[model samples]
Target: MSTRNSLRSAFLQLKRRSSTNTGGVWSDFSKRPTTLKINNAPIRQTLFSEGNSEEGPASLTNGDERLAYHSPIAIDETFQMAYRILEKEANSKYQIVDRLEKSLKNAASQEETIEIKDRIDKNLIEAEIENPEVLYNAEFADSKLLDKSQPVYRHLLKEKWENYDLLVTMQRLEQLHVIPDTLPTLVPKADVKVKFTHNTEDQFSKWVTPGSLLPAFAVSEPPTVYIQEFDRVEGSNNLYTVLLVNPDTPDLATNSFTTTLHYGLKNVMLNNVDNSIDVSKLLKVGPRITFKEYTPLTPEKNAPAQRACLWVFRQSKEIGDISEASENFDIREFAATHGLTPIGAHIWRQKFDRSVPGVRQMYGLGEGRVYEKVRSMDPLNL
Candidate 1:
């Protein structure tokens, strides 16, 4: 049937169902007389008990009165603001979907097409419910699509739940160029695993999420890390360099991306250069040469949490010793000059807020000093 005819039929069916349902509820309405009238003697609504206003002009003085109140100006302003935000969001969503759809329509292969389609579907779902709470509450809120490791997504949830410190840290990671702009992007299968290990503890970990204990517990002891790629360099001597930096230092006021180096290690040789060795257990053989020793992360009081970013770069054979490098280390320039390609990176956060006084004391920052530090770090005064 035609669309118009189908709608008409549907409406007729609904009307019939409504009339017949619930013991013929609509039958009483249908049987009511269409014409009805009353004597024009001024109908008296029981304003207060059973009083007639016509008895005396002032007889109904004790009646309850209600005045309709509304703030049309404020309501209109709020509605306009809401509309603008929603409009901007909707426009952004449609643009992304359109762009993705176009790309998929022109996809080269079936495999690529399927991948693109999946991404499109995921985008649509994300746009439909931008709020994390709605998605979290949904029955079909697929865990596969929800990447809590993503800085933005993680921060949204943290902000919703009032995890203030980690939220700032996550945002700082993005701002400092530690994480790529296109992140939450899939890592290629060929990429090697560069993992972190604790010196005091035997357990190893991959991702250092904000919710994890790495933020607080890691400050006690330095963590050991080894890259898998250097071990696999067959019949050739390869050295690696590691550097860690905290961009949120002096957290005194505003977050300045200018960094303070936490640790640096250089001239790292993988196991014995001669014998065949397992790449996975390279740290078990012997400790590599340490250029700069690990310094514990110390964030100032009343500041945003600090992100301790560790970058591992493959040392070029042409470059000599870099042991005397200063704390104001430049990772990008050092990489370029020495032909050092960054193999992997890791990040963990730390904070010295009022909630954790013991942590502040551990760093030798006194209570008076902490208050002074708070004054210095206030962004508003700056």
Candidate 2:
């Protein structure tokens, strides 16, 4: 019993020494105070405390400083707050513009008008600076973000057309012989899109492709033309002339084809944004713009397919009195006489169908003639 007691006492002493000794293997596992006394004050030791001793805790008021200490959730909240502030500022700016425009229209004095115009100019400059991405990243630009009056959006549209639509239009023109057939050649500088919206229920009411074949009923009425100008000249709207001629009008007497002018517009004012010439515009200012009112192409029965060549020209100056459209209209001579620069063109094909007769009667075109199908004896004649 004495020897057992001595062995137990010795074991207890050894365990206590191991627990207290700092050099022992079990010293790290022993219970110790979480903080150390520094200058008679308790200082909590932390992983980051030592490294950040020189700099104090991150600021809660400053966004840049607070972001350093924020978690992902907190960062997201900060971003949303910033977005809301920016949106509010944008709305306020637009409201100011609307108020200014209204005030300008109802200004009482010349001084007031001048002051309002100056403010508007300043606002436009600010908008232009803030909205340059629309021009640079045009391909991914949203249509809702585009402001037609802004030059940046206009330039973007111009670049877009030149990059994609213009190339396709040029290819179609060359392939279909619209260049040589209508005019000797063309150097297009503007983008043109044509559509006939007379019959909304018809399939061709939307913008027509450059070389599409349309049924007679689809294009029985006058077309709406959009001419987008890329070259911008400040404080001046360009004068344009639009001509629609059919280079495939059958001449039964000569056994060949002749050109006929179906529509003509002269001295029509156009700008980057306000570019379309539609029925409403005609109704508003028909006498000033219309050189020759629209006459629908009424193909005779048994006639071959016809090409409706639409041409757009940029005039150096306003054109003077011009003769009315006729069956043998000379497009080239008229363009030369008026110094009209060919800037854009479009074409669509039409053939005789059941709808042609009704369309002719509606347009006041008297009885149409039917041509006999001429056949050749030679197999290679086809």
Candidate 3:
């Protein structure tokens, strides 16, 4: 009986100590040192601190250290609320834009049209400011957002092309001496890409690189071209001219090189969006755009590699009927006469291959001349 009474007394003492130990578990946690020591140097633990108060917990630092704390749940809720508000605002602005566009189409007078256009522009600006990712995110950019009517979209595409495609094109042109060899110089303002889609099985069916080598059969037919004009004026279309010239056409008699015009197109109307020159485009627009039809380059046997330099020009005005392109053509004189401004250029090299004979026959061209391999003579003794 005495031993049992002693055990009960000990349990009561333990319960009293736990109850008086800084109130409870939370109170004890709050009393913990707000700063820890590493290498005898004090480092404040801000993560577990209280509100953003100038004074820390009374139990730590004698209220000298400032404390900042955040709740994960509160932060998550705040972000979600902000995102919803932004989404609603963006949707409202888009609706306004659509309504304004509809009103613009049915505007009674030029003044009404101008007013609607201004409102649309203002709303578009506000929308972009509120949510820039929709306009600037290239990887996930929507096709509708990339409309030619949107100036922001146009600028984004222009920047992308200038930084990548245009830079590479300029470098290749300089390295290949296509500058002085073809025209005096060029200041490209457009993005031009070419591909041969007639033979889908050919490796060159896709857009050809600036200075890549292509087989004769791959380029035996007309090519599809894309010209993107970034400086396009709103509500106005641009007229472009495309010329394909072979600057490495050998002159057996003169033992020099001469340029030959392989394709010439003029007065092709283009805008930021409708910018492809293909068979379908030609059929829809009629044959008026083609001044000189396409004739693929077929280099003669045992001849040097030929460079097909394609140039894109912005015409000052609509050009009248021009003469047919000649085997020996003067590109500089023609450009000056027609008031053509060089805007972009592309190139692909081709050499005499076994497919050359088959391509020539397919195009109804006569057999190519085979030149004998000439040996270089030894240098004279000093």
Candidate 4:
């Protein structure tokens, strides 16, 4: 197979696995190659691309819609509750209505979108006889995860679960009880040389603090990451795992978060500090690979700032035979269960607020594109 074809096939395999395990969002993702030329060099595009006409309001079509249909059933139940609450509050109902309309218009299929619109419109026109809480009881009758008292849970519904990826990450962290008070520092100050070289600038900051958003253009492609542990003992076989995740996939329908495991590497032998690990090259190795490759960063407009996180873990020998953990690999669970502790980490924020000329070339989005800013949850919220 051609190189491009081979890569696409690999992604197809992952897409099937993701759909089967994680609600099947990837199964419906577009197969077209979305490419862009930056400084006369081409870069890969985001995983999902909703093929909406370029002339229409960008708000109507951005990010993934499959997440809406195949999301956890609880999300749909929550949306129903939000709909009922916003219905009673006449003062702030229009804003919610407009958002809902946009989502309905952008549904994955015409039939599905129409069905949703009809059901919700019917509810809106009917008399407010039933309490929204009553619907919650009926819909989530068997669910223990729902808690009305916790605004955070309610907030997830309000935001349409856009922070789904981050929330899941936080859930794992909370389970392990890591980072008791403050968010852990993303990148530790070490002798490592890390830089994301762009034509406009090069990012070599000593550290990136949590809760800050970096422009998507600044991180269009994977950065050059190198680590050197001078304190390593002689004749030691030290294997490390590097993980990159985006927990802020803006679901256009519900405006909630869904996560994408952008990149992950396991059993990478870090023999010496002088040698560096090139992430892009490592992706070429196959079969055992968890995710396909380092997908370029393109945070959708009108979505929350994406938390682009990188975590490093030192593998322990006692935690043997981790080859079985592939589909929907949960980093938090893997770390806790396998006794792997994160040694170094870093985070970059990306939002689709500004026009990235580079990305425009890839998606065929013309100039003067403006992405409405939306409120995203803090990573430390968990």
The models' CA-based lDDT, in order, is 0.46, 0.68, 0.71, 0.45
Q: Can you give the lDDT of residue 89 in candidate 3?
A: 76
In angstroms, how far off is 208's CA in candidate 1?
A: 3.6
TM-scores, all candidates, are 0.39, 0.63, 0.66, 0.39
**Residue runs of model 2 more than 4 Å from their true location after superposition:** 1-145, 234-237, 375-382
Global local distance difference test of model 2? 0.68
lDDT per residue as tens, model 2, 1-382 = 6985565456444434333222321112242111111111111111112223123233234655644442332332353344345434544555677789999999999779778866765554343333212222344435333445554456667767888889989988888888898899988888899998887774688789888988778987789898877665334338889999998887655657789998899988888667889889988887888778788787887777788899999888988888765788889988898999999999888888888888888888887988767744333322
lDDT of 4 by residue, 1-382 (tens): 4985565445445444432212121121242111101111111111111222122223223345432222232343354445445444532333444566778867998678667665544333232213233233324333223332222223333233323433443453344333331234222312233346543553433233333456656556566666544333223337666777665555444545555666666766654422356555455543343333555557555544566666767667534344533324466665677666566554556767564556756656455334455454433242
Using TM-score as the yardstick, the better of models 1 and 3 is: 3
Model 4 lDDT-worst window of ten: 35-44
What's the TM for model 3? 0.66
Candidate 4 lDDT (Cα, 0 to 1):
0.45
Per-residue lDDT tens digits for candidate 1, residues 1-382, read 4985566445444434332112221112342221111111232112111223224322233434212221232333353344345545744765687899889878999779767766765554454444322333222233224343232333233344334433443454466545652122212111122234442454434434432334444454455553433122422336666677765555334534356666666666643222122233344532454545556666555555666776666666635656545445665666677776665555666676443456445655454334344343236455
**Model 4 ranges off by over 4 Å:** 1-193, 198-213, 233-237, 251-255, 279-291, 317-329, 337-339, 353-382
Name the better of 2 and 3 by lDDT: 3
Any residue pairs clashing in model 3, and if so which? none
Judged by lDDT relative to the true structure, which candidate is superior, 1 or 3? 3
Candidate 4 is scored at a TM of 0.39
Residue-level lDDT of model 3, residues 272-381, one tens digit each, is 77878988998887488888878888999888889899999988898899885567899999999999999899998898999999988988888989976772344324
